[model samples]
Target: MSVTGLPSASGLPDLRQVTPVDEVGVNERVARFQTRSIKKESKIEALKMILSMIDLTTLEGQDTPGKVRQLCQKAIHLHDSMPGLPHVAAVCVYPTMVGVARKALGDCDINVASVATAFPSGMSSRKIKLEETRTAVAEGADEIDMVISRGAFLQGDYGFVFDEIAAVKEACGDAHLKVILETGELGTLDLVRRASVLAMHAGADFIKTSTGKIQPAATMPVTFVMLKAIKSFYFETGRMIGMKPAGGISGAKLAVHYLVMLRETLGNAWMTPEWFRFGASSLANDVLMQLQKQATGVYQSADYFSKD
Candidate 1:
């Protein structure tokens, strides 16, 4: 079967042999945290703290080639327009658009990210997935955002999911790989945690939530669970993986909350774009709005900030 197409179980090796971590240990710990106490005030405080740390800017899914080119121009303009303007961590786009972003961003230090491996639905064969990742990297994508095999993962086929991620990582070469858990479909917090651990063990450099294709994406509870997983994984492996909570993460307050969780859970190490990012298109406007509020002490209308 082609890597881009789905593989039947009979045609592939059992993934259990390649997995590195103890599944049971991960599952148990994740379950235990489900009932743990989380103070409302503490949560709010965490959000506020992280918001302060954020570059508070992002650009996603520019769509057309011309539009992406324009977005890149805007980024350059923003770099010069705003005083103390912190550069966005990366510009995210569809895999096919990687080249456009690369050219648009030029020699700028900002990263160009692409979603690959049958993103939004990881039902394709491993061969196609690997090629997609390789192709994206070859096209100058500094980072790859690939989705996990949610169907197999939900069915408890942990080994299949594990192997897929490992193969994709191998294909990524030097580019950073961000594995999207699609946490919205993972159902329970325990499952989200397990998926996070599984991705990390499979050599994921970052674990992300959602493709923005499903509902209830990137919620506080879901992000909290993933962050805890990151902390635990660090304890076990001594490697600090990145975290990205995407999908419907619009508005400054909500974005700040995500940052809050990252800071409180992972500390200062994760505040940078290297360790954290917001995968959003509309979020930039919200962040700008909030910044305006901070600067002028007044809320601004969306119309004031251009959506392009």
Candidate 2:
């Protein structure tokens, strides 16, 4: 069933043979996900689950050791006022801050994820990308979130993109590799689908939506297309890959809708943080507010939460 130009052996399916996305169908499907209703108790559980699936990220030019430590503390002690709260899945920071975050998290269950391979832009040489990945892993980063070269993929150099991801995966050693497609720059849903397939075939543990620096980051239609690609790839090759929709998702209801989409598309198997994640730092406060409102039947001020 491999498409002629897809080059599955080389870890890339021919783009011409890749299925063309039906934008209308995808949009219609995503619209339906927003309409599904969750019971009160179920919504409470969903909020907690969302909290645990967050990759609390701080990827900015002004990031410092102190800020990274504060972010780690927030991750470790999320709303200490609450009786019980699940720590986030990971703390995402730049490669230089990987050591800071790793030391700050100590032995907590939360993973330390570093964005390597010229993150956000993916404009550097492959050698530097691989070296950055290795350095992060050596610094105790449990996961590596590498951005794919959108320029290469956009120019139809699928092989280059595939090889780059494979190289990064190899450089990751034992650390999991999450490949960011930066769907915002991908331009079309069809291209997004192609990139998703290309990434998974190249040994990506997870296929991410964006780098959170793009305007149209992590839209439902884009995430939906990526999820479907993951499901299709899993059926083709018995391997389960994870999904992350970073940026632009900051509300509890919308986040819950994403969970609904994930459940319905990939089923309950991909429900955990290992298989899915939200790459938003501000999302945590919104979810916390929602949880408090649900518990006490009233919402709290956003000022109550720390904004690190």
Candidate 3:
């Protein structure tokens, strides 16, 4: 069902159908955002805002209870040496580590987000996916980051994708759902745009760009395409769908550039942490280094900030 309460069979566009994206035009438009210069004061503010919008993520198969706990601690206290720093929006972990994150968090302002739907690869049955979502929420996940079945989607099964998202939305209960499109695997800008619309119509609170697993993840041009989709969706439905561009974003300069693109593209209304997020494991440290550089007038080493 869509936000306007329309049935998928009646309202959704078929996956195989799409208007071709102007690749050169999108590339040129995204390049312009990088040229807009931000002053020092504004840069500092943007850096902090970027910090607050990050989903400090560790989705590795080797992730342990201690690592999740450590990440949760980092989420709570991001470089205590720098006072007045806001924590990252959330600490995202695998479903199995949500309990450790919850216990470690212990009622902080930060949220605990867990990835389900077999994550990274949505190759499982609907029964297992729903169970994964429910179990994550029951284990104290404040937010659920669910992956879409790209295989089903690419196989020309748009209904399967819509139904899977709707079912996951139902299983989320109170937890907000951030649907990962993994646009890198989607093969084209048209597909990325269509997937964004499809996810939002199916009840995603946020449409994430990637799971950070695929190569060439979360590029500026790809993010530009999705933001355009989001802007159009908001215009038509009067419903603000959040956007998260995970992976391949590491430097402070690039992070601030993303803010520039986001603010200019969606305006100030969509600039809050509620509507934006960065799902990266190493970005926090880089942001911290930039903050320290701004404060002390010198470049700082990675050792200064705690490792991710």
> Candidate 2's error at 140, in angstroms?
0.9
Predicted candidate 1: what Cα RMSD to the true structure? 6.7
Clashes of each: 10, 4, 0
lDDT of each: 0.73, 0.93, 0.88
Ranking by TM-score: 2, 3, 1
Q: Superpose all Cα atoms of candidate 2 onto the true structure and report the RMSD in Å to 1 decimal.
A: 2.3
In the range 227-278, model 2's lDDT, one tens digit per residue, is 9999999999999999999999999899999999999999999999999999
Candidate 2: list runs displaced more than 4 Å: 1-9
Q: What is candidate 1's CA lDDT for residue 263?
A: 61
lDDT of 1 by residue, 1-308 (tens): 12321334423332233334444554554444444453455544433333333322233443688878776665555424335545567777778888998998889887888889987788889999999999999999888899999998877677678788888988999999999999889887767877887788888999998888899888777777788888987886799999888878877666655665566679988887778877776676566665556557787887766554
| Top of the candidates by TM-score | 2
Residue 73 error for model 1, in Å? 2.4
Would you list the clashing residue pairs of candidate 3?
Answer: none
Candidate 3 whole-model C-alpha lDDT, 0 to 1: 0.88
TM-score of each: 0.80, 0.97, 0.95
The window of 10 residues in a row where model 3 has the poorest summed lDDT is 1-10
